[model samples]
Target chain A: MVLEATLRGIRLVGDRTLRIVERIGATVAFLVMTLVHSATSFRRFDLVIREIFFAGVQSLIIILVSGLFVGMVLGLQGHETLQNYGSEQSVGVLVALSLVRELGPVVAALLFASRAGSAITAEIGLMKATEQLSAMEMMAINPIARVVAPRFWGGVISMPLLAMLFSAMGIIGGFLVAVVLIGVDDGAFWSQMQAAVDFRHDIVNGIIKSLVFGVAVSAIATFEGYEAPPTAEGVSGATTRTVVSSSLAILALDLVLTAFMLKGWN
Target chain B: MERSTLNLWVGVFVLLGFFAFLVLAFKVGNLSAGGNGTTYTLIAHFDNIGQLKERAPVRSAGVLVGRVKSVRFDPVHYNAEVQMAIDTKFPFPKDTSASVLTSGILGEQYIGLDAGGDEKMLKDGDEIKLVQGAVVLERLIGQFLFNKAQDSGADKGAQK
Candidate 1:
């Protein structure tokens, strides 16, 4: 009996693994179909506007506040180190480079994923649960164009805007800390920062990364939502998956983009 | 519904804020270009380029007038060759010395120029002859620890 139970436990685990694979595959297929359909029926200007409003505009506060604090922390840390070496002017360079290249995009993407990803998943899941998606199909309306397109486009546009904001705010935060709190001269800090960063390359690279992140977040959330089963349990599962997948995608893309950008194609 | 609308407004405000910030950064930060000034080009040879990167600033008398453009390792000498661009206005004599200096304790490295008084100024593409290379941090830290160990050893011997 004990032996039989052990075998049963192994079979259950195998079945669970297969189930997860099946769900993931279904989501991928649905995402591809959504993308294709949206591309074919690309006449929806209103959808794009709505997307920009929702995805880009909604998450600005958190990005700014977080960016500000991050800058402050960097300044504080950099000041201590620079003070040790009597090179306090270099604090600006340290803070600026850190914000422009790494912190800005990564932090913004994570924040956006949390805000927009959850909403997209919950909205799609509810639509599926309430048969709204099916009703739209019966009415000869393409749900992908009507629903998914707006969110996707919004995410794509908003991410870059948010990233730019984050980087800017972070610089200001650093400036405040370096000049006011740390007692460094304002002119020196600004000059050091100017010397350190390549504004054109750094800003453009950050925006490009943000756009990619936006796409990943929207695509993952929309996939999870559209594929959610009709039950309440399905909605929760979709929400969880959307968050996890988008966060993972953001981190992975960050690594890839960092490597590519640092490789000096510019 | 209402939450979505709220989100939309917030995003717009953030975008506006970002644009304003960019304008402010460029303005207040003084990231602008002016007429070409006096500058000099210096080449440094190194066995290892280490963490030196392109666009790293070059400073003379605590003023930045140029930057390092590229780093290439010469196969003939098996040494890293660093090319620096200086403003045209800052005159550097032929006898001037160039050294790689760290910004902070663990901060990025830059090329520091010490102005020399030669009768002639270094023209475009002229290389500074006396380069002091980089002061590697690991070696400095190691020396500190070794000296401390030696001092402790002497103290113990005296006590015995």
Candidate 2:
């Protein structure tokens, strides 16, 4: 009897786990559909505007500060190493390449994910826990459209803007370090950069990567939020999942994009 | 309503900032819109074209006069062919020497032109002779290692 009961309990747990997974998958599909439909929802202008503001404009300060510091550090380290070998003019290329290729997208995504991802997860989780989602359904409103779409659009727009801001600030930061700290000639820095850097491909790649990151972060966050169970524990779990999953997705996407971008270089 | 209005303003501002930054990048960085300017082509043949990329700058007296338009290997001659575009204003004299130069100890290689004393200017398509090839970094590193090994050997011999 004891063995039979244990087996029954295990089966029940396994069934419950499968149900949760199915629900999560369903939520993701629903989110994607909602996002697609949002393209036609002209009435959601307020929501879209609010999201752009919250995600992009308000987040600029942090992105700028962090980007500046990152650039400064890169310049300081790169300058020291390059100086040891008597090749200081290449600092411009190093700063520009690193900022455009890696730092801009990755740093912006990580920052946005940490700040907005957790907030989105918690807000949606709380809504679910409090039965607000059910209330929206009862009122004949689409919760995904009303709630998730705005945040998703906001993230998609904000991430790329944040990345551009980061790259700009990073370049300035590197310039400051090179000119003031390292005593590299201002003319040389600008001239060398002008000659070496190509804006068309590198800047476009950074922006494209940022857009992809934004989509990933928003989708992951919304998925985690909408699928949270009706419990406090579930809410916290969703928040954790949103942050972790978004960050990991950003990193993985970065690696893939980097490989594609650098395929012919080697 | 107030929140939405605020959000609108914020969006406008962010858009403005992004555009402004892009303008600044172009102006401050002096990024050339590729293929926009008058270009004269100069070709150089190299036994080895290490770390040379297309669109790399061609410098005269440390000023960028042109850029490497393309790099290809001439299998018949067994030499790397580099095509560069010089600005229309700066006519290259026929005797100019092209040497591959590295920017720093650890930097990308670019072609540097030494203007030769020839009153005759190079035309639309001309090949620069007297090419000084890239400073093979691997060879330099090898030389450093060998020198260090020789110094160590001499020190040990003296001690013995």
Candidate 3:
């Protein structure tokens, strides 16, 4: 009896695991289809340029403000902690390394998810809800090529640039707080950061992370929208799913990428 | 909005992104000042590298001239073999001695070069002959205590 019950429980878990694998396979297929359509969409590059403005330009303000405040907080906290050990001069290194390695890309992506990601989902979901997608199909128009591809390409192009801006601004904010405001030696601030932060190791890794996050976030946002039910409630649910799932995806991918990158270091 | 205006904004955004990249590369990270220009490799041997790591800076008389490219253990020699990429701009005499030195107290260790009066200069792939390993703090304290004990012992003998 106990053996039979255990066998049933194992089968239950195996069934659920298979379901998740099936869902992942479907998502990947959808993403590949979107990319295939995006090839033709590239002919009308104006649509992508417009989407870039909407997705990237519109999200710049929040990214810059959050970046500056985060850097200032890092500077204040780092100085307070390092001063105890009489190493306040190294605050710049602390701020730069942490921002470049962890905070800048991850935080910027989280913000982008809420800002542009939700917008894309809502727009696409609303189009589906209003039967606009059906109307496009009736016109023999390819909605994925015309609508989805542009947004996907825009987001992919924008994420790394936004991340770079965040890192650059945060470093400036940190310098202002640590050197100008808190009276740490200015030369030590920049020089120590230069010594500690390697271009290929830290900066390039940060760029790579933002690019990965961009692809994951854009894919999740677009997929959720395209698959949403043609109703107000379903569209709303997909928008929420876009934000939550993409946020989780960004963090999980960051962990995996960080582990792989750090292993390359001695 | 005007089509030209929209195009202008996108162009501006892309330009801003590239500018941000430049600032990050030069200001935040050391892409401009690092071992980027022309650099030649030099090898050194150390008994104990302690906590020295790859990409550590190499300085000659407090001025940075290169970077440590790699660190490996030589099985036959039983010593640490370090490869440094030194800038071609700063050439050192072949007889220069390399010493691993720490900055301040509890700071990161770097390789420091003391130039000799040799006529020849260190070339690419040349191995530095004189190399001093990192100074471990515990070993220094132990040596100091041992010398103090010996001095007190001699004092006690003279009194007796």
Whose lDDT is greatest here? 3
lDDT of 3 by residue, B52-95 (tens): 89888899989999999999999999999999999999899999
Tens digits of per-residue lDDT for model 1, A18-106: 99778668766776776777763358555666666666666777888998999899999999998998889889888877777788888
Task: Write down the TM-score for model 3.
Answer: 0.92
**Model 2: pairs clashing at backbone N, Cα or C within 3 Å:** A87-B104, A87-B105
Q: Higher-DockQ candidate among 1 and 3?
A: 3
- CAPRI tier for the interface of model 1: incorrect
TM-score of chain B of 3: 0.94
Model 3 global lDDT (CA atoms, 0 to 1): 0.91
Cα deviation at B113, candidate 2, in Å, is 4.4
Clashes of each: 14, 2, 0
Those runs of model 2 whose alpha carbons end farther than 4 Å from true positions after fitting are: A1-31, A41-43, A79-83, A86-93, A175-184, B1-5, B27-47, B85-107, B113-160
Model 3 fnat? 0.75
Pairs in clash, predicted candidate 3? none
TM per candidate: 0.72, 0.75, 0.92
The lDDT values for all models are: 0.78, 0.81, 0.91
Give a tens-digit lDDT track for model 3, residues A35-104.
Answer: 9999855899999999889888888899989999999999999999999999999999999999998899
Per-residue lDDT over A178-222 for candidate 2, one digit per residue giving the tens place of the 0 to 100 score? 888888878777766765455655767778898899888888888
Q: How many backbone clashes does candidate 2 have?
A: 2
When sorted by TM-score, best at the front, the candidate numbers are 3, 2, 1
